[model samples]
Target: MLAVQHCNNSALHVDEGFSNQTQQVLGVAPVRCRENLNTTTNPTAAGLSMTLGIVSNIIALIILAKAYARLRKRSKATFLLFASSLVATDLAGHVIPGALVLRLYISGTAGGLCNQSDATCHFLGGSMVFFGLCPLFLGCVMAAERCMGVTRPLLHARMVCTAHTKIVLVMIWLLALSVALLPFFHLGTYIYQFPGTWCFINVLDNTSITDVIFVLLFSGLGLAALAVALVCNTISGVTLVIARLRKKKCHRRSAKSHDIEMVAQLVGIMVTSCICWSPLLIFGLMSVIRSYSGSMGDDLETYRTLMVMGVRLATWNQILDPWVYILLRRAVLKKIYRITTGRSDLKGSTFRRWEISSFQNSMKSVINRN
Candidate 1:
């Protein structure tokens, strides 16, 4: 009986010991968590970025909406359709992620949203993927559209009607959506980016199969699209320059200045689009290569800084694209002025009509020359 009592007492002591150990572990957990929180995020920087993104996207959206309002049903061009689609993606990419970041920043939490695998994290990551790619692909489509307009004017006119453009836009969005959702389905992973401002695909200096496959595939596809766009833009620009030169050679004094200006404008759009997207993609490819080869080096700080800068640069595309559209499309600018000044002047309407007519006349000349 004494032995039995001792056994029961021993069991009680063991239970108490295990409970004490658990309590100690629990006590240490919060401290470790606090340390992690402090290290992972720069809340001030995040807030600043989010605020800027929010404000910029808002202004861009307002301008686009006002301008889109002015497009008469008969004048809905493919370029305008694609521009509207670009605005939608920019809105989603900037506003949604920016709002979430602001919420987390204001709540005074650090690092990720909730835990790493939480709903908010997935949403932000997926959104960053979707909206990030949307503009790029849409830009390519628009570039291709322009190429068609310049190179195959009759076919482009027949094929790229308003309904056809809408169908193409739908397809582009669906493709981007599919790619973005891959991470959520375990094909890839999305983790909180450093300084904890945003989330992106696995861009660490180490690689997994998923990371390698996704990065290479998407980067290849994106680069191909960008390349196609660059080529199209080059061809279109050269064609325009040649056309302008031919007109100058003929000594057609009328509208020669406008032709030169328009050619310059098209070249600028092409150059700007390429400049905005190229660095991030190139850096992303290099990072992936280094990760696979295990040559990432000891300077994680450099890698982190470069990654942050690359992301910011990529985001500049979203911010700048609307302004590019506004500056290049005279109709959009006219609408903005009218909206801002609340101008109901007949002169404004007539002037806009004249601008549209002039653009049509220019397009016809280009086609005829080609």
Candidate 2:
């Protein structure tokens, strides 16, 4: 009986030690444990959200694959490749992290697993950062590619091949991965966030200078990418407009139409990204500045709630991105136009006149040269 009592005491001591370690590592107070547990009480909602994201991304991927197969022989294949990569990345973003969350929920531990396992927390946190930034980077790359193609067609055609684009995509992935891994190198740190559903870079009221810098770097890169995309898309759109106005008829109708389709898609992508991601990026900047300034004392909880909302908003970007390409195609738009306007042959009639004018101009030039 005495031996069993001693064994019970030892077990109790070990439990206390484990609890202390978890509290220290997670930087969560004992008072907040109940709150975190409560957050997971409705695992059905979280599971459903994850399920929707995963399924939407999977559907987008299938559509993109079909679209890519159709365009694989064209010069526009490069843009499709980029779009496909972005969708695939977003799919992974949803699947890997969603699986982890669901697993924790199923195990009935919810956030407890992350509180206990530093490796799991870091991996989840890094993935959040990595996936969050990759789409922004890829958007910027696509915008720049389209800008170059529109503004400097000769130069763009000479360069920017499929092999080079693949290399660029790999480089962008590495860049985002490097940023995500920075916390592991002591540049900053990841900690269990409020309600403890997942881990992310620490941006709480007690965030350190390094943490502030890390958050700033993330938001800054994302915002910069958006800004660059805006500028490039604007320039590409203007160039296309000017070219169309200056040359009412062109022999390269197919190429011109392709450029227009690409620019329209880029515009849709830029708008969707800005709408979905700006909230989180801006909130991140504000949180870090407020934390660094020591001015978030009374409003800490408010800011935390905002951060959670911002993250939810950002996640929608992945879901909406693929639809931009899927529905923004010229064929799709023309069909919609036909349905609404009751003019099935409007585009063909309009383009036929331009084609005849272009052929006449070609003949005139040839006859004058002769």
TM-score for each prediction? 0.73, 0.83
What are the lDDT figures for the candidates, one per model?
0.62, 0.76
lDDT string for model 1 (1-370, tens) is 0000000111122244555577588884221122123332345655555555556656766765765575433223456567667766776666677777666656755344312445766787788777767877887787787777766767876787888888988999899899889876677677666555466777663467787777776677677777877787778777766765775699642333333333344455556656766776777777767767788887555776676677777767666665665565555555777888799673636345446656677677668768
Regions more than 4 Å wrong, model 1 = 1-76, 113-116, 251-270, 329-370
RMSD of each: 12.2, 8.6
- Summing lDDT over every window of 10 consecutive residues in candidate 2, give the lowest-scoring window: 1-10
User: Residue 242 in candidate 2 has what lDDT?
Assistant: 75
RMSD (CA, Å), candidate 1 to true, equals 12.2
Expressed as tens digits, the lDDT of each residue in 1-370 for candidate 2 is 0000000111122244566678778996633232344422445665666666667767777877887797665557899899889988988887887777667656755454322327777888898899999999999999999999888877987799989999999999999999999998887788766556677787874678998889989889999999999999999998888776666565443335667888999999899999988988898889888988898888887887877778877877877887887788766776787788788676455444444554564566458668
Best by TM-score: 2
Q: Backbone clashes per model, in order?
A: 0, 0
